[model samples]
Target: MPVQKENVSTAISSDGGSGVSSDRLQAVARGDNIPAEVHKSVFETTPVLKINAFNLWYGTKQVIHNISMPIPRNQITALVGPSGCGKSTLLRSVNRMNDLIQNVHIAGDMQLNGDSIYDSRMDVIDLRKRMGMVFQKPNPFPMSIFENVVYALRIDGEKNRSVLEEVCEISLRGAALWDEVKDCLNDSALKLSGGQQQRLCIARAVAAEPEVLLLDEPCSALDPIATGKIEDLIQELRGQYSVLMVTHNMQQASRTSDYTAFLYLGRLIEYGPTSDIFTNPVLRETESYVTGRFG
Candidate 1:
């Protein structure tokens, strides 16, 4: 395992929670996709998350090797890998969710807006609040839909019915489900269809006001139409939050991510702009997997 870095700021946290203190993220000029200029935007525009030499293990067995990558500010970075490739494990490490599982050990430097997640000074509660996650299955809390969205806010000591209601509306709207569920906020989340339930989970994640959103196969259990809705929601969220998604679906990765990291057998085999990965993969493994030759 790599030695973990001390707490540090990867980017400046400005007014928009962009993590960069600068205001120089000029929109990329006409280009093939993300050019060198766009890569530079990580520093100028403020990357919301940065993971450097991050490694993790369960008990004494290592899962993720030394993996280092930058998640661009306000863009989606999809982690695509075959089964047992550590994509989900890597995602959990970002938010330290693995810490909750027994015998699970971590050796990594996961930085959210410049602070190492393992740093002793790092507050897990606050860290999780800033880096919310949506799981593979839509596990809505057994409560009213409104309550699910308000759970975190309430945990953070937010009271006042009017304030909660307003924030709930905003979050649901942001998840693109307010129009569908506006009339039934008080209904049980379990009553909704699979797609609506998934969107409700998204709303709950968003309600926490996280800067980085980690999704683990968020559409794996949904129908095509529902998947499209989630994809659209992810697109609409690009500018407001940095998204890191784990997906086995190659086409979905190509369609939704700005950058893609291809992992195999616990190693990050390729990491680059999505267009390049799809059109011209550099590694034999990446090309084979993305081209449907073999996972």
Candidate 2:
């Protein structure tokens, strides 16, 4: 059902903040087909990835509705929403990771640097090569740190030791982990602390020199200190790599992302600059969700 003007006006007058009624939020949670309120500023920046009318289904169940947005180049974009809202599903779709799930299907298209992502003629491996992905938890290969960082190059048949060493050092420096592990490059990656392991995983991803980095709750499994470190690294990555991240921490999203997209019940609710979405949203639903009044 479409949002009624009376309901919105009444809610705005009744509540000084958020200005969203419980009935309206409930309607959204019920899978109602409310149109997404995308702000104009979202298109002001050059997009490295564009999602156009994207939809996804797991077997017969639809999870992602007709969502569309542009991820700005060399900026961090955060996808924020309650659990089970298809944030991670949409992130994985960028690299075609969703194809691994049985009975999963998607319609619409995502373009990376103007190339169609869902096109049948596209090379899945090549597509993945252009993007780097980090998961919820730190997943470092059991091999030595050096081996772990250079795994992608090895897979591509890189045999020169000097080239591997140079790339490993550069990637580790980029991930801000070189000074700590420089002497122990041969140590097992599993032996590192939780935060170090996560940074190592980031270094591994960076070694590929991907066009975009996909982070799925990269700091969710760590302690506050580790999370802070990861957040710092994410900030350092801005202007160097286009980052599309799914995060549940509101403060983290506001602190790290340039653009923020809020989703509910598999539908996009609002998307725009982080400052506007958090401080002066175009819709009360967005304000309510961001201010913790409702979700």
Candidate 3:
């Protein structure tokens, strides 16, 4: 069954201030198919990211329908769907990576900490600084391991060697790669194994002290051992930073995420706690997808 959408606009409170008016979001999502309202219990903490009546298109082709959801702070939320279902597209939108693509158009409201990211006064660089992203493959620069982790800080103009070194160690340790690479900080990052390189990417993302981390299939290209290590790292990351991950692996979603959102054909089909979404879904389409009956 399809999700329902009522035309009534809604308002929310964040950090003791008013949030975006639903009227604005309604206009942003004009003519798009909005998903049903998510249950309040699905979110257990103050949301770090709120997406309301959001839609996206490339030229004239719509790729994301009206999506309204809240990503809880300090928890892992996974977006799961089949290929080309807009999972990656939606993830990229969090940090505005999609803007680099030609002919991209977007509407509706995306808020981080109750501030509208798309507002005219918002700074794109600062927005991305608050959110870290790790791509599907580990594309480390041809630099030393230490430099890779502190790249973001350097770009932001941090010149203190002590501060950079401290951040590098802490971030690498947080990503569970410090012990393995601490002795060889000056070695080329590309010389590490695929799993180590991916972990390095995670360390790099966190060096800037972002509030959220976005992973686009961070373990897709690795073997079982590497995948297991990454999964463990994700588990450790819980309660420290809000994480949003896009994964095709259903089992990985169940293993690592506290919440899950299901999408199909550019529309959100179902979303809730990870346990409920996997064992008991309210929608037949979600049940079919989880049970291996259909995608």
Candidate 3 regions off by >4 Å? 1-34
Which parts of model 2 are misplaced by more than 4 Å?
1-20
Worst 10 residues of 2 by lDDT: 1-10
Tens digits of per-residue lDDT for model 3 on 1-295?
4334333433556665444334423433464454553555776568999988888999999989888899999999999977888999999998899989999999998999988988989899999999989999998989999999999999989999999999999999999999999999999999999999999999999888888899999999999999999999999999999999999889999999999998876777678888878886665456556766545
User: Which model scores highest in TM-score?
Assistant: 2
How does each model score on lDDT?
0.79, 0.91, 0.86
lDDT per residue, candidate 2, 1-295, as tens digits? 4332223532544445444555655777787777887778888899999999999999999999999999999999999998999999999999999999999999899999999999999999999999999999999998999999999999999999999999999999999999999999999999999999999999999899999999999999999999999999999999999999999999999999999999988899889889888887777667777888655
> lDDT tens digits, residues 1-295, model 1?
4223223233434454434211111111111122111223334545678877777778888777677777888889999877988999889888888889989876668788888889999889888888779998899999999999999989989889999999999999999999999998899999999999999999999888888999999999999999999998988887788899999999899888888888765666667778877886544445556887656
Q: Give stretches of model 1 more than 4 Å off.
A: 1-45
Each candidate structure's TM-score, on Cα atoms with residue i matched to residue i, is 0.83, 0.93, 0.87
Alpha-carbon error at 200 in model 1, in Å? 0.5
- On TM-score, who's better, 2 or 3? 2
TM-score, predicted candidate 3 vs. hidden true structure:
0.87
True-structure RMSD, every candidate: 13.3, 3.8, 10.0
The Cα RMSD of model 2 versus the native structure comes to 3.8
What TM-score would you give candidate 2 relative to the actual structure? 0.93
TM-score of 1: 0.83
